[model samples]
Target: APAPTPTSTPTSTPTPPSHAGRVLLPHPDFRLFLAIDPRHGEVSRAMRNRGVEIFLLPPSLHDPDLISSSSPSSLSSSASSVGNGTATTATTATTTTTPNTPNTSTPPPPFHEEVRLLASQGLFGSSRRLRAAVVAAHARLAAACVRVHKRPPDLRELAHFAQLASTLACRGWPALAALVVAWRQIYLRSLGLGGADMVVGLRVLAQMVREAGVGSTLGVAG
Candidate 1:
């Protein structure tokens, strides 16, 4: 057999580990936890130019319950009815269609009463941070009310402010009492309300603050 031809087995090449699967890697323009308050639009832009990727921590990440009450159907219904009354009648060539609206046609309850009812129901969620924020905001509102009215805030007023703070916290924003105070001040100023007249303005101010704080947070820019 002529030296039985030397048999050689081919060696298989080892595949290198993929960078795509690696958990950690070095890269420019890394994610930076800059507390950039969205209200400060100018500062935010400046930071973005410095190779810092601003990562906004969404409320849902921390508190899934933030949008738990906001079901698609509920949102759609709320959207369709906002500022247009409960039912909007559409006139067509052949027929008029009036979508079946919820019983919201009834005038909303008085603002203070509504707040009291919400508070009684324990509308606040179960987050320690949220609770603390709400308590601080409530204290601030109470103090402001005392300073303005020369008297302690009524139970309804306190409840209303507490409800506001809790709502803001639940939505994952710092329940800033200063913001609420500013909102009330501005509304009162615009209405030229003084003393007792300011009490009535709370309803409008609450609505304004709630609308403004939607999908908003507080933090230092840059």
Candidate 2:
């Protein structure tokens, strides 16, 4: 009798990772996620090589907080989302192949309920107090960055939280968001200052200040 022929095992190709609604990186030791949306695979790879600890995300899924979450999940879970870049971040990064489970944990409740709501309601009796609250909020947020990141929060993250806080207990979200965007533009185009670009930036800054100072409120948009 002829010896039975050996059988060969068939192999399946791996699926490419999807970035949408998934947490690609582990959150070192915090609740909020630092998300990125890398358009190219190389971009994600480069950041990972640098040990940036970022995850790939889709621009459309900008709002991590808005990601429909269920019961509390472990921080160790693969599900992730972004901070501050929720609305209009143009950056990108890598993603994981986790089953599409929504993020389980929500950020802590907004602190100082009075201050967060006072600015938007026109209840602030003095600019001094309003300015003080904003500054204090900024300081309050810096603690997280220093404790975890070992440095003061960068302008981008700082502004992100500032705008985030304004979305609730601080002031007008639009104005704060606009200010964050303006600052971003200024930071990006810092070289353009003392030139025509500076004029444009200044004009925009003035317009933003004027609108914010109007002491009017628009309902918070989702």
Candidate 3:
């Protein structure tokens, strides 16, 4: 018996859409707060060495939306007093003013909204037309975390990190969001958020990092 030959056709792999331009790493501070086993203290030190600050404040002292915008002149004066460490000053000077007047006029960005936007876009898009700037930023952050963190994290964990980033973004802390995206993608993968307990724990950690920044807190960890 003779077998007939079959013809094969070649097809192109579909490319993911490109993410549009958005603020990724807006230069806001990055904070990492979790109970560090003494073994991981080295990482904390490394983060500080790299100019990423660290803080160990108690939970009672938590607040993220307490930003107080300042007049450019007043900010400049305060920065000069702090000397040339402008990165440090930028945060302190920006958040130093007592908000004598609360800005109830404008509502802050919400978490769900950002999530909806993210879900609409494929988790990662093609090189040419990626998703939003934030997602692309997260991918970069995830890659960096793979290099730095003790264990590499997977896409699910990275997605959770994305959610946390969105939470920060809602708080007018887009830069913090970007940093979290990067750090989580880099470090928090295999660690696994675990079950509901881990979810609660991560929320706490996210808040800790958010306030550890200079704009919201009085100073940077340095």
Candidate 4:
């Protein structure tokens, strides 16, 4: 008998993400943070040239609740955790992850509860503000990578976010770092809290990037 020929399975081509509707403008302060000119056109090229291999801060390593919220199993887990208050007091940020839905397995880091304790120290108008700021830098990076592209990020975009994050996270951000350091000094003065306070520092990050403005602005709005 003749040897059987090997069969090849057909592979499907992945569809490219559509650049439809409108192109979103990247945030200005964020552009500066990455050293890209705030002006539009050739944005992607600029990012590549910047050689963005950034720092991944341990504090913002992974947001478990935000990551888990996207998981199908999260609802069930949340309900079950009701009996285990040990899980309840762990985190503070309530924002959604953009670009990439992070791996839920990457357990939330310790400061997950840091914001809550810092809240009572009278740093801001509300603790909610602190929470938002904590994740603010991460959120801006997500948008820059692809979330603001007028559609959900594809695998390629998500990968881009991860790269951008790693580079951005490792290197100290001048503006953001300075603010954090200054606030920490003030932290000693007012609250007598340690010089590692993140409340004010995080807020400075949030202020730099415009949240959700990418999709809303119609150049010809009446």
Per-candidate total of colliding backbone pairs: 0, 9, 12, 12
lDDT of each: 0.39, 0.36, 0.36, 0.32
Among these predictions, the greatest TM-score belongs to 1
Model 4, 158-184: lDDT tens digits are 223323322332344342343344333
Name the lDDT of candidate 1: 0.39
Order of candidates by TM-score, top first? 1, 3, 2, 4
Tens-digit lDDT track of model 3 for 1-222: 789888888998987568656557744576545544321234556655766444544332232321122111122232321235653432321222234322211112233323333342222212111122233333333333343442433455546654454444444564544555544553443465345323433443443342333132111111
**Model 1, stretches more than 4 Å misplaced?**
1-45, 59-64, 69-180, 186-200, 205-222
TM-score on alpha carbons, each prediction: 0.23, 0.20, 0.22, 0.19
After the best TM-score superposition of candidate 3, give how far the Cα of residue 202 lies from its true spot, in angstroms: 19
> What's the true lDDT of residue 121 in model 4?
21
**In model 4, which regions exceed 4 Å deviation?**
1-72, 79-150, 173-222
Candidates 3 and 4, the one with greater TM-score: 3
Judging by lDDT against the true structure, name the best candidate: 1
Q: On a 0 to 100 scale, what is the lDDT of residue 111 in model 4?
A: 34
Q: Candidate 3: give its CA RMSD in angstroms.
A: 24.4
lDDT string, candidate 1, 52-163, tens digits: 5645443333443443332212221232212334644322112232443112111221233322232242433333222222333333344444445544344555455444
